[model samples]
Target: MKAITIKQPWATLIALGEKQFETRSWQTKHRGPIAIHAGKSTDKDACNDSWIKSTLAEHGIKSYKELPTGVVLATAELVDCYKVETTVGHVSVLSNVKVVEGLEVAFGDYTEGRYAWELTNVQVLAKPLEAKGQLSLWEWNGDSK
Candidate 1:
């Protein structure tokens, strides 16, 4: 399956549904079932913020420092890719996300981090492979099976 490698805490945030948008600097034309791969780089400063902590707390989420990086944490189908609208009356929509089974992921690159990357044979952890919840699948990739 195709997967996009994302930097640390953001990936965690996305997995936990703390942050919705993946915040891409550029736009993507591809949309489909993609693996949420967490990278080794983490935002250390943001990790200690009260807002972040509080938000997670409200959702009853605990510190995820124990979770490994550089692997796919969860899978979601990308419905569409669009630019962030900062204007009024505009809501960033991931559209129709379908959360895949949650899995414990490792840290490291299967291939150099690049756009539109595909992966196979990566280790999908047996534990924590339960469905935490559902998410929007913005873009359809025809891999729902």
Candidate 2:
């Protein structure tokens, strides 16, 4: 399986299905089931953001300690990747289609030139597998069965 390492609260958000898009500076052609890994490093500032905290609270995540790190937390299909385009007044949309404002706010930068990697069918791992993280999409040779 292919895996992508994501920083803290964002990784938890993805695993919990609250975040549907993973923003990246680059786009990928690989589209299939991929493991979502929470890197050892956390985005401490994001964890303290009002929007992030409120969003996590809405998902029943009260503390950053509840989020797993340095492990493969879940799996989801990378269905699409599109550039985010934003206009005046915080209106943002993908280059190919319209995206919900909440999703854009929760999962993306909502700025031009960034790619939105759409994820679906998220399945959290019952037992998170410990693994070292890599920068981009990487192959995970471990048994997923």
Candidate 3:
């Protein structure tokens, strides 16, 4: 299976199905189910943000304490990847999707050059599988159960 290493809260948010898109600097042609790996490093600054805290709380995530790291926490379908020319256009992409305003900000960088990796059918694992992650999308042999 293909997998991508994402930083803390973002990975957690993706696993919880709260984040519909994973923003990236590059684009990918691959599509289908991919493992959502929480890299070992946490975005400490994002964790300290009040909006992040509140959004996590809304999802029953009280603190970053329980967030998994260096593991594949879930699998989501990589349906599409695109880049919008304007910030307004970027934000509008989620208008049809139900996403909290704060979460949209937390999960993506709506800059002109960034690519949004659209995901669907997110399935959080019953138990996180430990693995070392690589940059960009890499292959994972572990079962996504």
lDDT of 1 by residue, 68-140 (tens): 5655576666655433322212222222332211111111111112112222223333432222222322322
Evaluated against the true structure, the overall lDDT of model 3 is 0.81
TM-score, cand. 3 vs. native:
0.86
**2 versus 3: better lDDT goes to:** 2
| Candidate 2 off by > 4 Å | 87-90, 143-145
Model 3 misplaced regions, further than 4 Å: 89-102, 143-145
Give the Å shift of residue 9 in candidate 3.
0.6
List lDDT for all candidates, in order. Answer: 0.45, 0.83, 0.81
Listed per candidate, the RMSD to the true structure in angstroms reads 11.7, 2.2, 3.5
Top candidate, metric TM-score: 2
lDDT of 1: 0.45
lDDT tens digits by residue: candidate 2, 1-145? 8999999989888987888889889999999999999999888788888878888989888888777889999999999898877633445677877664754465557678788898999999899988998999998866532
Error of 3 at 62 (Å): 2.5
Report the number of clashing residue pairs per model. Answer: 14, 0, 0
